[model samples]
Target: MSFEFEKELRVTETNIPGLLVFDLPVHGDNRGWFKENWQRAKMTALGLPDFGPVQNNISFNATKGVTRGIHAEPWDKYISIAAGSIFGAWVDLRPGESFGQVFTTRLDPSRAIYVPRGVGNSFQALEDGTVYTYLVNAHWSLEQKRTYTFVNLADPELDIRWPIPLEESERSEADLHHPMLRDAKPMAPKRTLVTGCNGQLGRAIRQYAEAHGLEGFEYTDIDEFDFSDPNAYDKYDWSLYGTIINAAEYSTELCDDTDNADKAWRVNAQGPALLARVAAEHHIVLVHVSSDAAYGMNKESKTIAPVSLYGQTKAAGDIAVANAPEHYVLRFDAETLQDSEQCAKEVFRLLDEHTAYGIRDFS
Candidate 1:
């Protein structure tokens, strides 16, 4: 199937003005199809959003480059590879920002990269067919988005350097003359909040944050806050946070026991509803983690499929959270062990026992 990819930029530069929309038409045939690489008039007519590009250009790479980018400046770009493959990466040089982070993804003929404004980015061609295209939010006047060769590793103020030489060309040579390289400025920090801190998943998230050296996060676990309690929303400060990872849930194992269904509904369904409602009211990005058991009984009911009350209630919970606008639900399965033996070990043990006792045959 063919798809159309487009984007509207919302920024202003010294060389370009107003909203700009960039779109590419993708066509498909028996041996694959073609697309309009870039059209200036079509974009202008589409009423480009905010920032528009004044010039368009393309690059061809013959080999993988050494010492590629982990760099950024006060510019934004939309990049796509028309052919070949490369490992594209970006580092938040936005300085002091909370998610001033590093992200990397592979760019092939199938994928594109949207490097945000002010983020440093670079890539290395993996094959001979590599063609890189970029749309800058600003026009190329004196050549922008350039950085000092050793600013990150040399300057006592910034101390930046490249372990190897950059892949240089006429385009890069022109950018070396920009003024931003002479006086670099630091960026402000960002803050994030995490919800559902006390549950097993919450604890794991906390552990990951600590391991990754993430700071400025306000953690709210079950011990500190209870979603089941109606008044739980009043005690906390909601304005300081922007993201909420909802790891709260009712354990599904209870479905195996013959208990009142109302209790299950309250915890599995109503609890998440309350949290999501509060998140929407506060404008927080809620990440709701769910379970795959919600898919219900499959053909292999005795094995891979879940045929229990827990699965049904979890499915209901999934629907509830999805209805909330500011909520994101992620469903997955997990296994845990109380002793040295895990669930896999127990499954194997039971299988071996069944075979030994003639309950099943290995052959």
Candidate 2:
């Protein structure tokens, strides 16, 4: 698809399939300079994942010629130099074409690189106090076993030519003692992610899990994981969960707005559909919690006539789940609760423990 990017941005596709360099336009005036670092809409238009970042990391170098990394993981990365400069390099480690070929670039604070999965990445600072920041798309859970595959920067077999001599560079103890990529094994996911913890179904699931002594489940709320971002729900090891319970929904009246309608489709429809496809691919069971909104003013179970955009999106989500090879959609009413006593007990438990507590006046 042909598209026009923002004037301030230039996406340069590298020789590597998924690697791309973003040259940001810096506006310099009499005072200072400014640049738009990241925009999901723009990134998506340019064929990049449009998900909210799962993790943000920063690495600071105290001296020039200090090298860190040649590390590879199971997820994609957005790396940008925030201060000073570095001779950054990324090597394709995916078994097959371009297995050991390296891509080298001189990175300053203004430029950023998109590193796809299965790439060994490294950098050597050219200036003291150089800062590097990376945005990753994986939900990190240390409890599950994970092995970080690494390659020696000066490996003769890989023939990765460094800009400066290795004798002149300082390396970390871990880097000096790491194993080769070919000998490494992939990491396993630790737990199933239960998103939308603040919602009714999510809270019920967490309470049930805690009461039953069930473990290996990660609880997250809307604040932690935004479902609308296309890249928000990927890179998790599907083998971790037999069944993924999706209790999240966007049921606000704001869906009536034309601008907000797209968000509803993204969250309630496309997001769930993608999740279902992933689950089916790995033979994981997906128990998707849907809404009565899917029924709307339809005549029977098969026919659907959505009265509102919210209902339309919910119906779309249901259809998405139905298309999956192994999926179960549970339609329910969110307005009524079956466990008022249990909720009250939990609320009272909170009130008794805290000195400063919030008591809302419910009319």
Candidate 1 has its poorest 10 consecutive residues by lDDT at 354-363
- Provide the lDDT at 165 for model 2: 78
Model 2, residue 351: displacement in angstroms? Answer: 50
What tens-digit string does per-residue lDDT give for candidate 2 at 100-199? 7778888875678888766778999888898888897665556222545678787766666677777789997888866665654333222456666677
User: How well does each candidate superpose onto the true structure, as a TM-score?
Assistant: 0.41, 0.54
Model 1 vs truth, CA RMSD: 16.2
lDDT of 1 by residue, 1-363 (tens): 124333232222211121122334456657875665544465434543223444455778766552244455334466767877666655455443322344555655445555544565566666665788887654443323232121231223323333223433212433343223235444322235555566555666666667667665567755677665678878855443445666666676665675757666766777677777766554445566666677665524522344567777777777777655555555555434222123223332332343110011211
What is residue 169's positional error in candidate 2, in angstroms? 1.2
Best by lDDT: 2
